[model samples]
Target chain A: MHCLNVELGERSYPIIIGSQLLGDAQHLLPYIRGKQVCVVTNETVAPLYLSRVLEALSEFDKVDTIELPDGEAFKTLDTVNRIFDLLLERRHNRSTTLIALGGGVVGDMTGFAAACYQRGVDFVQIPTTLLAQVDSSVGGKTGVNHPLGKNMIGAFYQPRVVIADMDTLATLPEREFSAGIAEVIKYGLICDEPFFCWLEDNISRLMARDPQALAYAVDRSCRDKAAVVAEDERESGRRAILNFGHTFGHAIEAVQGYGNWLHGEAVAAGMVMAAELSHLRGSIEAGLVERVRALLEAARLPTAAPQGMTTEAFLDAMAVDKKVMDGRLRLVLLRALGDAQIIDDTPRELIEQALQTCGAT
Target chain B: MHCLNVELGERSYPIIIGSQLLGDAQHLLPYIRGKQVCVVTNETVAPLYLSRVLEALSEFDKVDTIELPDGEAFKTLDTVNRIFDLLLERRHNRSTTLIALGGGVVGDMTGFAAACYQRGVDFVQIPTTLLAQVDSSVGGKTGVNHPLGKNMIGAFYQPRVVIADMDTLATLPEREFSAGIAEVIKYGLICDEPFFCWLEDNISRLMARDPQALAYAVDRSCRDKAAVVAEDERESGRRAILNFGHTFGHAIEAVQGYGNWLHGEAVAAGMVMAAELSHLRGSIEAGLVERVRALLEAARLPTAAPQGMTTEAFLDAMAVDKKVMDGRLRLVLLRALGDAQIIDDTPRELIEQALQTCGAT
Candidate 1:
């Protein structure tokens, strides 16, 4: 098992990445308090990963499970209440630790449930999908979606530990895997030029599920994410760079209806557009934008925004996003393939031109 | 104005207490970042306090207001979502500061909405009711109610500042005034002896709307709570003592329905039962219990559990609280009238004896 520390003092925790590490939970026993355990999962991932986790967690005295409907809409206040129902049914308390055992949807919802159930409770992440294992599992952003905005409601509460089992990805769909690769590529594009070049060369090996290549990709992505999150856990400044394509991406997901387009896919396309826009505005060289388009196309991720989504609607949606600062559009622009900067005073003409290029017209 | 610092370091903010301070929002002005401000209040408190707050914050380029239905039942996820709806409608971004203007219920729901709206936004507390002015306004315990548990879904996001307008108490009903007094006395009974003695001598003056007495009560209670909360912001240790009679109090509030009994009224009775229970277990002297009983009775608050509530119902209700440390019953019992301690392993007999003495079957 490889342990990566997030290093934020007391709020810090370790990310355990390895194959079949679900059984390595005994080493994690010290951090857990109370005698009860409640595992929170969802419909899609439960049948595939729940039993493996249950078998592994059999050492704990009492454990209960609450399975939720599988979708972005399910990440709502109602779902949070359902977890409360499970916690009350099992009589879980402050000391009781909750286990989030699924993808970003379940991790976000479960982490939120843990945050709200009796003010807050300690919860562990056993992320099943590639997207969750690489990203959502580490950041302490716990919350449900409001009708108006995706993840509009949440808290910056870290998990007790993150157990990222790469073996679980065997059950992930091809489309989902492609979507996750988009985020995996995000780490390379943002902070690691060598890793970006490595990804450009190894996209097929990572896609073909070459165990070593996939493992390396996941670990590197998590490490990069963990480092940024540790320095600016709550998106104060440096952390905003981590949301490279999320502002426009959230607009696509919300306007397109969540679950229709995968989050990473939307973000992949959005980043290409952001890079293209930056190139036009002289922030980054045109060659870098072409490289981004080439990389995303290689991963079989979307490089174009969803059709029929109007530029006005897209702007309206992006305006409501938590990321937009001071009435100015805060767009994460690529200075180069491996270097990024979040520009708050993004020019309206540049944004409009990018939207038109991405078919948001 | 009286500045009460909560002492959470950088996250720490001041609670400004006085009459008509809402008219001069200079303290709140420094915390305002963006040009937009969204004031969250309820239908009831809006007509009374909203205009003053609006006038004070008129300097903001764009200001909006969302008035929700008043009452405990209104403290639901639905109401929290309504704030999100208004925020999205106004295109309020991350820098938009939410000002919670009303009683405890409004402050909690607004603060909770602010906590979740686009992950989080800057918020100010314009708490009008006496209960809010003293307690919920200062602490960042923001959340809405779940069907099973009170404050079932929420976060610990502190406001930029808390503006408590004591003059708003003029419009509060007699019942509401009495309810607010329950928490005021709690600070004394749990942590401060001199304050407890002072409360005994001044309860009538407070009830009579003596401004000086009211100011002293709010300041002292907030001061006591501020220190404990700084040590354990999310109720890890010393903060639990602040919940002296809250276990029983919340049970009564939940079982009887949230608005059926005023929170403070229920807490007033709960404190008496807790004192008696402490005596039953030999943790507190009977005379001290009587002194608590006398203060509650003098305030026209119930001293025993309500008429139709059965011990089984109470126990079932208590089991769902966030304070149930584990499967075991955790009670904040008085080591004396002027101090309290959390007993994690309370014997069933002592609980039964206290319930029986409180006239419950």
Candidate 2:
């Protein structure tokens, strides 16, 4: 087992990574400070892993579970309110700890539920998907989507601990598994050059579900992410670098409709567009863009925008993105592989051209 | 204008108290970090002061207004969602500052909206009611009520500045004005004995709308509340003392229906019950309870629980309050005329007796 601590003072917590760690009371017990526990999972994940967590928490004075419908479309304030309803009905207090037990959607909604439940409560993340374990679970960016944009309503609430069991990946669909790799690739492109080279060397072993390789990727991704988040928990300045492909990716998700494309799939295509724009800005060589595409292709992730997605649609969606400041779109473009910078002065024509290059009509 | 700062590190902000401060661009603009502004006021307040604020903000690049329906019944996640919808529809970006231009309901909903809108943006409080001016607007306890409890869904988000205009109080209905005085009296009873004495002497002057007396009361209440809040920003320890009377008050509000009795009116009655509980616990003399009742009576606030309210209803409602931890009901009771403490071990029988003493059947 490997444990990495996100260095947010007082709010700091550990991310525990290993195989079959779900049923272990030791990893889950110390972090739950309250006598009551509520496990929030989804229909798909509940059938697989809910009972293990419930059994683990059986010693608590009170234990409850709510299995929500599974999918990105269910990630809304209304869905989160159901958690609140169940909590209030069952009389969960301020000291109660909420355990999120599914993929990113479940983690996002449950973490948000914890954030707003009784004006904040302790929560633990048992991320069941690679997309969640590597990216969403670690950063403390918990929220729900609005009809107009993704993650438009939420909070930067940290969990008491994150338990990432590699065994859960065995149940993840092939497409979702590849989606997680998109974020894993992102850590390399944004800040860690050696990890990028390592990914290039180890992509096959990771795709083949090699436990050792998968654990290393998750650990390295969390370590890299923890370092950036430690410096800026609220995404004030340097933290904006973490949104490298998210601006374009959120646009894709918004235009394509959430759940139509997996978040990681949109990000895979968005990263390609970002890399192509980096080449257009003469910040990086065209070879790096091709390298990003090749790596994503090897992972079975989408390398371009969805079919029939137009540049106009991208522009409209991106306009309402949280990254836009003072009417200027802040795009995180790669200055070079392993280094990204947020630039607000990018010409619209350049952005449209990059979208065109990435197969946006 | 009298300005008091709530000294929360990095989250600290100034509360400006005076007559006619709302329409002053100088007071509003310095705290606003961006060019775009959205004023969230209810229908009642918009017709009174929203236009003055809008006119003052006319110089900004973009200005928008959203007038929600008035009253506590409308303070819900559904109502807050309307603000989110308008923000997205108007393309209000991360840099837009939300100005809450009404009483506590509008301030809380707007502050909470600002807290969750794109995971937080800047907001300023234009508190038009004395309840907001002295208590809610200054403390940074922003949230909407849940069906089960008051203030069950919210955040501890501070505004860039709080603008408390005393001039608006002249137009306030007499009942609502007395309700605000309930909190003003609370500051004196909980932590400021000298101020409590001053209120006893000036109660009639304050009720008569003497500008001097009102300003002094607002300033004193803010200072008292600010000192306590600074020591415990998240209500972890000593801050719970600031919730003196809220446990019983929330019960009354929940059982009687939210908008039936004003928040301060409910609190006024609850304070008497807490005072009686304090007396019953042998913490204070019976004279203090009578004094509290007399002051509330002078303020034209309720001195006991509403007629026909039953002790069982109070117990059922109070059991679900956010103050409850691990099934133990934590009650804040007066230790003396100017001091308070949180006691969670209060016997259920004594609580029922206190409720009965306060006219609960």
Candidate 3:
């Protein structure tokens, strides 16, 4: 296993990546300080891997579990309220660490619950899916979806520890895998051309869940994410690159009622749109956009926008996006496939063209 | 005017205490970065002081307001949700500083909103009530009440500045003024014997709204709280002393429903209970307890327990209090009027007796 530590003083925590780490979590229990603990997960993941986690935490009988409905739609303020209620009902204190046991949605909601439960409790992430292990579960970006936006209400709290159990990905559905690779691919396109090339070479092995390729992918991705987050935990500046496709992706998800597209699937489509915008704005070559599109198609992720959405509605939704600085929509466009920068000055014509290419009105 | 700083790097801000600080907020706006400002208050405080605050910020056209229902019961997760909703609806960004314009409840809820809005935004406190100015609005104790407990959901997020308008307290109802004095007295009881002596001599003057006495009280209390919070922002150690009466006070608030007694009123009565326990444990002299009780009575604050509350209910409710350490009650007891210590090893019979003295049975 490879380790990357997010240096946040006493609150700092580690992200570990390896094939058999799930079996080694017993060694990681020192981080969870208290008599009681609660592992929060979702229906999809609970059925496949909760027993394994419970078994991992066999030392603590006070261990309990809560199963939320799976998907991005369940990442609502109401869902977060439910988690708070559950923790309160069980009387979980600040030391009672909440273990998140699913993908990004589960990690976000549980981390948020931990952030607010009894003012704030410790939490650990046990990301079961590829998208989560490499990304969401590592950084402490915990929150529920807002009525008007995604990830709007949250805290920049760090987790106790992040335990990515690679074996759990064997049960993730094919479509989920494709969606997961979008984020895996994002790391390459943003800052690491070598990792991008490595991913290109090993995409099939990663898709097949080959232990070595999967471990390497998770480790390298988490290292990159941890380094970026260590420098800018609250998204003051450098953190914006992680949202390279999120500005457009969030609008897509918002317009489509959020859960209609997998977060990664929408992001895949969003990245294509963002890259095309970068091309039109002269930051990235048109061929780079084609390469991004080709990679998404190869991974079987969506590259086009959702059907029947209007540019005006998309723009309206994007304007309310948390990424919009001072009311102007700021897009994180690729300067090239291996580089990205935020663009607040995108012309109306280019945006309209990108929307037209994506089949939006 | 008296000034205190939170000392939390960029999150650090000042607390200004004086008789007429409401109208003085305009001078503090140079620290405010953007044109948009959102003032969040309740109906009662709005009519009393919002106009004065608005008059100070007349230079900003984008001033918006979110008026929540007034009272401690309204300090719920639902009310916090409403604030986030309003911020999103209004498209308030990080540059938008939330001005909390009421007592502890509004300051806490607003500060909590600032902590979670867009992962964190700047907020200023224009605490209108004595309880807010001298207590909750100073330290970064911002959070909403959970049905399970008071402040069971919150963060230790500091404000950009705390503007305590003592003149606003002139219109405060007598009961609320007495309630607010509980926390003012707490600062003396927990950390400063000299201040305790000072307050003992001037309690009558403060009760009469003597401006100089009020100014000294507010300033000293903010100084005490700022020093503790600077040393321990998250209640890790020194900060826990600030919750001298809060464990019992929280039990009272939760059992009676949040607004049944003003938070400080419950805390006032609770301070007496803690003093009684301290006497029983030989940590403090009974004479000091009498003085604490005498001062509370002189302030016209409740010094004894309420009628008809049973010991079992209080005990059960307190088990859920945020101060429960390792499944046992961790009580903050006074060594004297000003020197306090957290005792986790107190005997059950002693606590039961203190409960009996407070009419909890």
Query: Using DockQ as the measure, which candidate wins?
Result: 2
Q: What TM-score goes with each of the models?
A: 0.96, 0.99, 0.97
lDDT of 2 by residue, B1-361 (tens): 8998889999989988887776788888888888899999988988888888987797899898999999999999999999999999999998999999889999999999999998999999988888988888677889998887888899989999988888999999999999999999999999999999999999999999999999999999999998998888988889888778888898889999999999999999999999999999999999999999999999999988899999999999988888887888999999899999889999999998999999999
> What range of 10 consecutive residues in model 2 chain B has the weakest lDDT sum?
B15-24
RMSD of 1: 1.8
Full-model lDDT for every candidate: 0.84, 0.92, 0.83
Distance (Å) between predicted and true CA of A357, model 3?
2.6
* Proportion of true inter-chain contacts also present in candidate 3: 0.65
Which runs in model 1 stand beyond 4 Å of their true positions?
A: A359-361
Best by lDDT: 2
Span of ten consecutive residues with least summed lDDT in model 3 chain B: B19-28
For B143-186, candidate 1 gives per-residue lDDT tens digits of: 88877778877788899988877889889998888888889889
lDDT at residue B197 of model 2 (Cα atoms)? 98
Tens digits of per-residue lDDT for model 3 on B1-361? 7777768776788777766667765556876777778999999988887888888888885899989898887888889999988888988876688888888888899999999988888888888888888887666888887667777788878877777767888899999989888998998999998998998999889999998889888888888888888887778777889998888887787788777788889999899999999999988888888999999999888876778888787789888788887687888998766788888888888988998987787
Candidate 1: tens digits of C-alpha lDDT, residues A1-361? 6778878788888888888876665645766888889889888878887887787778887889989999887888778778888777776777888899888988898887787777788988888889988888677988877778888777777898898888988878988898899999898888888999999899889889887888898889998888888788778898888888888889899999988999999999888878878888887887888888888888888888797788888888887787767767778888877788888876787788988887777
Of 1 and 2, the candidate ahead on lDDT is: 2
